[model samples]
Target: MENRSDEFSQKLLNEMNALYSLLLLFFYLITQIIAIYVNFCLVVMVFRTIKDEYKYPYYPLLFLIMFSNVLFVAMTTAIAVLGGLSRIVPALAKSFPVLIMIAISYPTVICVLDFLLCIHRFSVMFWDSEFWSIHVRWKGPLIFLITLPFVVLISSISITYSSLLVGVEIDAFGVGNLPLYCFISDIALKSLLGFLTFVGYVLILLRVAQQNRKVGKFTDFTVIEQAFPIACFQLISSILTVFMHMGVHRSAWSFAKVCLLKYAFTQLLCIVVPISIIIGNQNRRKKFRYFCVCLKPNQVEPANHRVCITMSNNRTSTTETSF
Candidate 1:
């Protein structure tokens, strides 16, 4: 009886592992498809807007957001693909550490970029003249340069700690296990960043809402529409990350399950937000309407103007006779 029980338990475990492997492959394919669609849309939008001579300060920030999204998709897809194949490919299995670092770095950079984009939009709407001044642009680059070193230093330290304490080990069948790193510290940092981003975006949303209330018109819905999707994506991604971190520390849940959930949430963001932006543009709607109007033939002009003038002259003559 004891031997039979052991054999049955082993068989069950094997099935679970096989199921998890299939899930990973499914998720990887879905994310790749979404990423390709997003990249194509971004390219089209950028090409359309590139020749505009107006100094729309937000263009650069939009471009940065799109570029970051592309990077996120590419890096994330690579991680998923390589991670899935690590069981079959020894080279990929060994390079898992570097791949993990790249994955983390891509999202970190993207988070920072999202914050900057929100701040840039706020500055443009509230302080248009000041934002456009030459001093602001020059100073901005200097600030980034000054801060770049510190960001690199911090990320490097985190990466080193993560690599050493949480290495990946692969079995002969290509299954990989990644240990959790930074325990309390990682959760705290991620929570802090997530909270900060959420707050910033929420405040911006409130400001826009307030302005819209006063104006009784939404002059530009593009920013508002895009902001909500981005905020939702950021919030969901951050919360899932924290949850994954906690799950890693607990033995009750499988690490693979946590990773699958985390990546699934990420796939949601990569698939939904950018696509919503492209489809929801108010300007694009107007342009489409105008195109339809132009395709039709023009109608004849009204004779009301000439008739009104003749009626006015006759009224003048009648008034003179009555006097």
Candidate 2:
């Protein structure tokens, strides 16, 4: 009877693991597509704006954030796909530690980038001259250097603690049980960074909005307003991550679902932010549309002859008459 009960328990666990692996595979593919698309669009948009001579010094920081997301998705998808396969074939399980390290570093890098972006935005709104003077460009590299040691220290401590809690489980057959290192500690750190980012964004937006209100000008405030969607996206993603950590202690399947939902929402944010900006700003949208139209072979015009001569002739005649 005891042997039969053990068999039943093993069967149930295997079934749950299979379901969880399938869900991870699905989310991995979806996030990879979304991350690539969004990163490409963001790069195009950033370059286009730069070409147009809109020198918001904080722009590069935003690019870094998008770049970090791209890296995050790439690392996560690789791990999910490989880890899922490893479940079926123990031979591929050796890479599990590297996968965990990638997973831990991906979000850590993103959180650091997000915090840097917040600081950049705050400086732009509140200390424009000083930001541009010497600190603007150096800030990103500085933050990276400062955060590296802390990340290493905290990650080391977390891994050690986690391993102690759930010792390294290895089967006689060479397949090892993966350690849940950095999961909880990383979430705690990210939640704190997310909160700071949210507050910084809110304060910057409020300041920008107030300035616009006083001057009765709205154009500059558009960017601030558009940023609200991204802010909300970050907030929601952070909350979901916290919930996922909580769920993991209860049931691994529940935790996997939460992770899937988190990535889905992140992809939604990636696609929605750029679309929102293009839709909300009519002038920029029109300019982009016109640019696209001009890309067609038949639509191209010689630069010297593109402008009608009539307007120039009229202006010349007016000058002659004045003389």
Candidate 3:
């Protein structure tokens, strides 16, 4: 009786664990789908809404970031899903390293682009530079041209590095051994970019404070104020992911748990950027709400329904006005 009871208890525990795994897998799939959809919408919205007055490298950079984010989320999802599939089909495991490389490359570009976007915003807000205004026509194209080489170089290196790994072991969670240099290089680059982006935010806030003091009272910084939290969340989400990867060496957490945590961090980062863009900016929010919330496509069109993009001391703000 005692032996039978012990066997029964162990079987129950196994069943419970299997159920939890299925639930977590379902969650990963759902979040990945949501991330991909949201980022794609943001890309479309940013592109379609560009007007003559919206001429700035800021919008272009934003479009690039969202586009990269969509690819990043998609690649990560593919890695995870394929990694699981490789368990049943051994041939699939061979492609895991290549998938890993594709996944790593995007986030590196994202970090660099984030830093560049921050610098551009800082320049326009802190210096109130005429440079962005004066060179408006060429600046956007120039920024893209300049960014292309870095993208190519990073992607090339990632491909080369993944090719170098032999007998790579991929776990069910798609976690695998990265070359030590590749691992350290990735972490270093992201840390540096993240720090610089934070500093840029600080300088922008200081500029806002200076303006407030000159006015002898507080002034509205609604847009900048809203953006601050979103930026912080992105940074924190990114930092936690790095820490989670680092903790893999020290902690006894299972590979599945580590992978899930990393996925959650990444998915949250991807989802939040679009959400912040839609919710933090008044114009984008109204446009998003109008299109997404309204059921009837033929709803009466309002007069003067236009989105105006304005750059002030802190950042570009979108305001929609309708008569």
- Among the numbered candidates, top lDDT falls to 3
Minimum summed lDDT over a 10-residue window in model 3 is located at 293-302
TM-score order, best first, reads: 1, 3, 2
Tens-digit lDDT string for candidate 3 (68-97): 777777667676676666575443334434
Report each candidate's C-alpha RMSD, comma-separated, in the order given.
13.1, 10.8, 11.5
Backbone clash count, each prediction separately: 1, 0, 0
> Once superposed on the true structure, which residue ranges of model 3 sit more than 4 Å away at CA?
1-23, 73-99, 128-178, 216-230, 250-260, 291-323
- In the range 91-170, model 1's lDDT, one tens digit per residue, is 44444445444444444554555555566666655666565433333444454446545544444345443322233222
What residue runs in model 2 are displaced by over 4 Å at the alpha carbon?
1-17, 46-49, 74-100, 127-134, 152-185, 219-228, 250-323
Model 2 TM-score on a 0 to 1 scale: 0.61
lDDT of 3: 0.57
